[model samples]
Target: MAKAPGFVSLKEILTTFKISRRTAFNWLKTINQQLQAQKLDQVVNIPRYGYKLTDRTKKSLTQKIAKVSSPQMGHETILNAHERQTEIILLLLDQEHYLSINQLAKMFHCSRNTIIKDFKALKRHFPALKIGSSRLGHRIISDENSIRLTVYELLLRQDKLVYAFINRLNYSFSQAKELVIKAQQQLHMSFSENSLQQLTYLLLFTKWRITHNQTIDRSENWQWIAQNTKDVLPTCTKLLGKLGGNKELKGEIVFLSKIFLCSQATEVDCINKNLYHDINNIAQEIIFRYEQLTEQQISYRVFTKTLCNHLYATFFRVKFGIPFSSSEVDEIKWQYPVLIKFTAIACAPLEHYLQKKLPSEEVALICLYFGSVNNREYREFTESDKLKRALLAEVLVVCSSGIGTSAMLYHELSKTYPLIKFSLPLEIRDLAKIFQHNYQAKLIISTTILPKGKYPIPAVKVKAVLTKHDQTIIDSFLRQEVPRKLEHNASAVNSLVSIINEYADVKDEKGLRLSLDKFIFPGLQKNNKADLPTLSNLLPAKHIKVLRKKDQLKWQTVLKWGCNLLEQDEIIDQFYFEKIVQLINRYGPYMLIANNIFLAHAAPSNSNKKVGLSLILLDQPLEICSRGESAWVTCMFVLSPGKEKEHEKALEQLVDIVRNQENINRLLKAKSPQEVRQFLLSFY
Candidate 1:
């Protein structure tokens, strides 16, 4: 029997392509499909991995080549040497070039004698050139472009590995086919289109990296240093023990190690240095903000909240050590809305620009707006005609639930009935003398049911019946619209101290026994204040320390006021300056100076000063201010030299005080600067 037409073995193909068994199998399958699609009936099989070219594949491939040469096909090929050599010689002459017989022999892989015979046949066809040999080299002296196209056409008939290269690089196969068509069109080259397809596919895979981002004819380096660096850094950090040993670490290390395979060591190091610098900058800023808020008794519990997206963005390059991608940037861009919203209610104020720039949807902005308005509920009061008449004689209402609740009531009444500022509680017995002592205050309210003649400050009972004829009751203090301030009514300072003392005197081992009893113990009270830091039940120790430091500073400042011999104005001025400095240091010099000195502010564009700043100021040196409206602010907070965060907070507070009409009025009324500073300071 005649041997079947032979073909290359799968093993040989795999070795030639340097591909794994599986990959080789896949390639063979693809080749077979291409063959069968064209209806060539030829079979080949490796009998392994269910992957082989079947009978139909080889016939299809061979027929595909034959179709190009078939007379019925649109294009024709000159297969005989004599006929092809005439065309080759004429094609070269058309471009003003001549190919020596020797050159033709080397190009076609034939003997010089065979090439000479081909040239003689070509001369008979074109009658143009002499067959000759030269020592320098059998050079091509004809049209380079035409000759090149001729050679290209001849090779195109053989196979299509070139076209396959283009497809593998992710270009559309149609696009790859178009490129081959253009090469053939421009050069009068013709080929079995199947051959070009095969060539482009191989080229696509091998050259994928280099050609990925390029769409034009330009070439680019497939290997990028930054890309390599990103792949390697995580492993380096993990190996150095900087990153933890969990799954996350393992994955990052693997990723980075792969990058090293693609990149040089120098590139990796450069990327690492940049990441370290950025991370350190962020960490240091966070630490400084933590310290500032701690000093202010603000909560820091929100600092640990980060979305999955933010974590990825921040650590991707710094920890994972990867080149940045647009996808990552986009994720972070959308994440800002959520991040800013959550941060609004956090204990520490966010960076000032965020507070100013973010809309009400942002948590910090919402929190600040809400914080500006008092929300405490208050009791409604009504007066009888008799009480109104007595009020003309100056009566006071007092509640002995301690000054806390009553003080709130006093403020409510005082705003509408400004005449009765001295409404002391019924506890003070010297009513007439107390009423006479204050020019601004006249009436008082008493919490306990007491007779009018018995108490100090011209007391009125809490339950005093109301009368319709008393217009002042309806028109003045009883008006419901005025809001009350926050009041702390739990345990009085004296009561708490006395209870603690009694417990200590009794040597109570059960802990705070008398204090708990007298105070009507709240839910889950700890025995020792010292235990506060250890209690995970409470907020972190960081929070408690912050609260303590703030309280300590306030009390210390008050104590200093009582002991100091300086003029009141001098004392207040010193305190105010201290506060100002603190704000500037905390927020940054530009923000502090702008907020405090320049008084720059802006409200919502849609509303008439509904919220936001009402004033703006420009920078000015102290020399100009020394002469002043000749008036220097008495209550200010100043940071120590070189302390930015403290200065920022101080500046913020100073601006807040000056902008607030009520606070400013209170400060101006002070008998001394110290009292002014103390009063202003207490408001925050």
Candidate 2:
């Protein structure tokens, strides 16, 4: 029949007061009516259990009980744990002297054990506040800033409680608001209404604390605040001085400056020249790095200005260890791994300047800035448009030697049939490899022999240079192979072109197409049906070569020997070997694809005659550096693809092998070239 801590069952109340069930029910109805009249929540009843009062309802009822209580009543009111805790905190803040646990127990009409438990619970919420018993008695110990933050948290939790406390201290809220307005006007900055309210409450609380002979310990970085926020510091100092002079004015100044810096307010010329320059430089660098990775341009002016404004607020949060909440960080990271990675790398300088490593959430916020800008360039395509592009036949143009001739043919063909997406020009020998990797290519137009039976896609032989007759043959072939339904709408394409021209400074149609293609489909465009080529097909036994190291050899010599093996096999011309050497010298051995394994090859050029692979296992390991990454080379593969770009598939397979430590270990441990080839072919 006893009442529970925060609730009392109707049965219990009836039994304890010796009342009838009907009377108890009627009393509950009256209480509900009164609560409703006061605009507070009524008690909720569980079907099988009892009536329960919410925390708000309990607090309201407790306040009403306290208001009507008198000493002549001869009975004390009971306070719940939350009410007791709030009372304890207010009491500690108001009094200069400490109150012992026994004294607090008598004051709350609770046992010392309950008071100790309340203090324990309160400590968890305010980590910065030290609550313990000393020779003097129990007291709350914390730095001024910690106390201020705790007060802010308390104010946020129960506004009525805070207002009551402030009212007791005779702090004028209206006067505080006036001081905040004066500060804003003097600093030439405007704060949001919410910010203004928060500042007013903070100033009022600070004045009350200082006047009660309780001064906060100075822990703020005044020097840093003065240097970085010189423009706003004077106004903040004046406002704090007006509230309460020099007792804790320095800490007050630091706190107010933080508010100004972090407020979601817009101000013209709020950022100083040096800080503006630094933020701008960092923003530009980030955008440039993003462009390099994506191969798409973004509007730098607007993005930089917006980023600078964000950083101004973020700088304060980072410097002062303020918590930043970003709920979408995980989702953004999952959706845009490449963007996040590049952004993190590009923001290294900002991180260093801030002297704090950015949390993933903060980095994800930065990604959003770039994403918003890029979204305007490449709006989400319609599902039908996506399907049309997906079904379009990818055509590869094979032209004779001469970059100029190949480029000219590519442009002409692309212009003639805008609907058909074409690959950059490839040589006839490279066609098979290019087709294997680019399974999306359903047709090939070659200027030389078709290399019959080498490709799965159909091939059309044309003159080294285009002619009117060749154009007719291409048009006839396209009619039969490419479905007419897959063609893009001319109007839609032109509209997209116009949109791009309006937003971007593209000089011509070719530039526009290239940019649009890159923006739409980043990385290499691939078909879902494109399967990775098997290792056996890419590295035949005849192509595998092993070398026995006689004494020691330089890393360059090791690379040269592998290239020579491919050249001697007639897989590539001498020019290919020279090109490979030139590549290594200029770019280093970045071609060392895996641990102790190097796959060296050059772009498909005139030097490459046919697709070829040569593997050389060094008896002695040679250390080589490639693209700033170093690897010990014990096994090397020299790939030469005829003008057909055969190396793409082989390179992809090699990367997979390198990624698998087990496969790389097995290959390195193989005794002979035949064993290495067998191990690689196991993947098939």
Candidate 3:
């Protein structure tokens, strides 16, 4: 049979191991560090500068390959270690005649002392083997075919023990503990204080082995002669006795544990054995069945099937339970189809549980608490109801036009505001369909009225150009300070519309707010739904009613809350940064990006005249994204450098006006950014 395929690419490695690039890099670094620390034969003659395993090292690694329980593994082994070790040894022996110890030592890159010890051990195990002295100064030993096979079996057993040892250390603490518990239970043994303490020491010792390459001395093995040893020491001594003393220590448990602890390695040997064995066997079967196929076709068919089988077993175990086995393994082996089918089956549970775990549904339920101030009962935004509230920052936009200009505009907006998703293809004829096609869109913005004239969507209209009047309208969209009661007066709506229409040319914050205030009536009439009117509204045109929405106390609270969530003395992790981006996405229609600052404003459905603070992230630019079910999150805002007064003032105005503690608390609680925007729009 053709030799098994080598690791093809980094992408293949990542997929096989189910590790991120960051994680894979770390593992590679760890391996390099281990190689350097061991002072093993200097790494040489490799394609890249990565550490190279010497022949002995290759043997060691091949032994580890068999254990599929390590965190580094994402597949199952189809062959046992014995079959693999036998094949490798047979290939090696067949390539050379009467190999000498010195030659083997040179290949393995070990000292004569190690080779002598290994030869001595082999001789003791196979007493019938003949030894010969050569004039060429080579130490020779004889092994007939049966003896070679017998030694291969022993090597396979040793490899299995070593693989198990490494796997126990690398997977999880719980897994290691479980193995210990199961062993103890099966043996029906109870540990004394000393034995228990020894186990703890063993755990630490194992950890040290992986981190620092070191070897354990024979004295470090479990002690039987020491009086301090307790809990059936005699039984342990007797068992060790049967396994043989230092001269014949084949697959000793205490020694195996020490090696794994010191090496910080895993059972790759077992995996290599199984993987190769399956490749060989599967290839033979395919070649036998398909008599006319080319070599490439046969190889591809076998390779693909092997990959599929591995995925099926791995994902099956992950989805159901660890330490799992089914009698149906034979059936699966015969009928397994493609890798995609395995992935779908494996991901089912993770996806199912994730949907249930999201806080979006609860946040949606909270939106119900906000009944229309005018008793109009405007429908709240709906979609992604099952996701958690924290994920709401991603928005899908919906518009009347088909996927032409509006969709193009949505893509442009996405570049400026990466947190939000848009549904503006204009392909969606109605708001409900927009919600259905992209439930993840938190709020909707449209250039035209809803075709049905009644929209469940929290819809807002944006002028083509952003003028001063348009700023007022956009400003109203940012503040939930407007009331639905304004719908009763056409003059109020007309005046608000005119002011918004007039300011379509102004983009400045001052110009934006000034033109926007023309639409608000501070003391004209007070309804229970209206927030405390701004001081400017109460004082009328003669006197400005200047109100500070965010005071010193609120700022302090925000800083403290931010610190707590970030959980670091310095900057928080990037996940929180991504969340802030999602927040912006849910709230605003038009946003201005100046370095780190993000500003957005959208109007309410009941009264298009009122606007609310759509969203803002001022502390820092978002630099992280989190994956969520039923959503693709690109919500991150990065602050750049510029110290201009206008920039600072604009940023402060946006933060102070748009992100007060009350508003933030509500926004943060919103199931999606759309909901947050709608809640803000409701204020208008």
Candidate 4:
């Protein structure tokens, strides 16, 4: 058959030149320009075909190609040293057998001296390989493992060379790829892009080694493998069977099982008995500590199960020295210091089991788990709900059933009537007493009917299951009563301003009254409170403890002791200690506001109903992770506050103390809680 006219598709040009569509079009335009300059026919595009060059245009292009190939223009075509070395490495790696100097010179179209120099360069780059002249040829000799690793590195450095490496294996990757896809489907999990690439390379490497009659020495911890990898053994067996199973396949299976175990699997069931027990115990302790610190109950079963699976994979990676990376460690530390700190403490047992300290990246991973758990629990209360809650007026809820119906009503009312703050459920009989006690209570919602004229507060009766009508009634009541409550607050503030003006000379009485009005009626305030509450007011003598005798204490012990003081004083719930430690673990010792002062805290929760401060002055300085600062921490200030608004004043006051080095010095010198309180009072 006669050859078809020389033609090239736009897609083919793009793939060949590695250029974009526009560039390809521009090249064709340039070619047409050159042909026009020569006063010959231009390249023509045929519909449903590609660009076709006329016989005359082809002859002109051939002459142009010859001109560009001249010695003066040939510098542009020459490969750089790095590029040449990469090509040589690929050539060596892809070859079925070693190549002689004369053969490489022929392939590279270079001199014998040039080929020898390239070989010398390759030998330097890959010291593990023995590159020297042999009886047969100049060859690269290395163990299968070393050669595979070098090839993998080359592929990583040049991703475009992946297909080249695969082709050189003389083994199709389709079967291995199918095996992975099937395993992922069967296991109910998916591998990450990086993981899939690693697996593909591994399969190809394994096949090459097996075909070459090369075997890897057993280096995995067999005991650990026997106990924990039983679940993945079947999958590994199937994979090896397809790869043409051999006598040394068990070592490869063990290796493959480890890789599968370290994957981000949804669940991990088979674990070493001792490791499982240790992980469970550690998880329980961590949850317990977290609960005590936050004073919030976490779903134990769900948290433990998720944590156990994650730790199992972590344990495997740590044991086998498998590298792991996380870009979110710093972000997690900054955002969830308390949770990460708690996670770190929880991870202590695992560290002991691994016989090494856990890296910050691993600790950050654990923090992510806790952060997820916390997010799931509080997913309902969004940012808008928080804003609306601040504007809501307090209302008493009366239910004869106590918590059950009242709690439901509270959540429902919170969503429906965003302007109402429903109090905890109270008995119908306690309505009169509640009315007398709660001056802010604007209206009362009741599940049961109440007697008329029984209390001064307005009452609305509704069914346990609120209907649209009930919502309308409650919404209507809030619309009328909320504004009236604001007016009442303004009037009270006006009265207080009048009293204050009588006692002092006031030039700006109007301005003073406006300020007082804004302060009294929080809704009227333009700016949130900027000043921190006085440290003396927040930290009482009862919550402070002074350690007079010198005693060595672990950083964990210091956190627990401070937390114990806060818990004893009813400043925080039990888990607050773990939260404090978690914060330290996540963010390091950045909380050390001064030379000796350590300010420990967590996010506000119900456990901290009121702002509480505990001061623990150690007799001797203790070591802590300071992110490269001095680790001698002598004074620990544990602050547990119920809400951000409630503690804003206290934190401001604390910051002032922290900023002043003189105050910190005085605080360190204080021998007793009374002394510390006295010194803090001096600032107020």
| Model 3 lDDT-worst window of ten | 365-374
Report the poorest 10 consecutive residues by lDDT, candidate 1: 609-618
lDDT of all the models against the reference? Answer: 0.33, 0.63, 0.33, 0.61
> Per-residue CA lDDT of candidate 1, range 1-684, in tens?
012345456666544433345544443454445456766543444455323344554333433222223121125321335333534443343233445655554444335655555555544632323433455433334322223223233233221222222233345556544544443343232332233443334223323322222111211212333453343333333332421223333323343233223111111122345544543444344434433422232222222111111222223323322232111123222423322222321212233312332223223222221221121222222233323333343444544322222333343344334423233333334344444543333334554445656544343344211223233443444333221211122344346657667756746534554455335433223224232221121111111110111221332232233212222313122343344334443444322222222221111122111111111111222211221221122222222211212223333344445545666555445553344435545645
Could you give candidate 4's per-residue lDDT for residues 1-684 as a string of tens digits?
Answer: 002356667777655544446545655675667678788787789876787777765665533321111121223233334455566666665566777777755554345666666677777866666665786676556765456555554543333344455656667777777887676665555554344555677678778777767765564565567765445666776887877866356776766676776755445555556666876776665565444344456656756766666676677777776545432245446654545555565454466567987777677766665555432322344444433332243787665422222344554555444434665545554555444443566788886567788777688987544666787787778778775532455577778877987899989988887777666554334324545455666788887888877668787777777778878867788877777677667646645544566777777866675677887888788888744544678788887765644565565556566547787777778988888888877766
Off by over 4 Å in 2: 1-88, 97-125, 134-137, 153-164, 216-220, 247-251, 268-271, 286-303, 322-347, 359-684
**Preferred candidate (TM-score higher): 1 or 4:** 4
TM-score of each: 0.20, 0.42, 0.16, 0.43
Please give the ranking of all candidate structures by lDDT, highest first, separated by commas: 2, 4, 1, 3
Model 2 per-residue lDDT tens digits across residues 3-86: 247456676765453434554565567567767888878878887677777777666664442221212122444344555577
**Candidate 4, which ten residues in sequence have the lowest lDDT sum?**
65-74
Q: For residue 489, give model 2's deviation from the true position in Å.
A: 28
Output the number of the lDDT-best candidate. Answer: 2
- Per-residue lDDT of model 3, residues 584-669, tens digit only: 44422112222222222111122122211112222222332223312211111222112111122222333343324565544434
**CA RMSD of each candidate after superposition:** 36.9, 22.2, 29.0, 20.8
Ranked by TM-score from best down, the candidates are: 4, 2, 1, 3
Q: What TM-score would candidate 3 get against the native?
A: 0.16
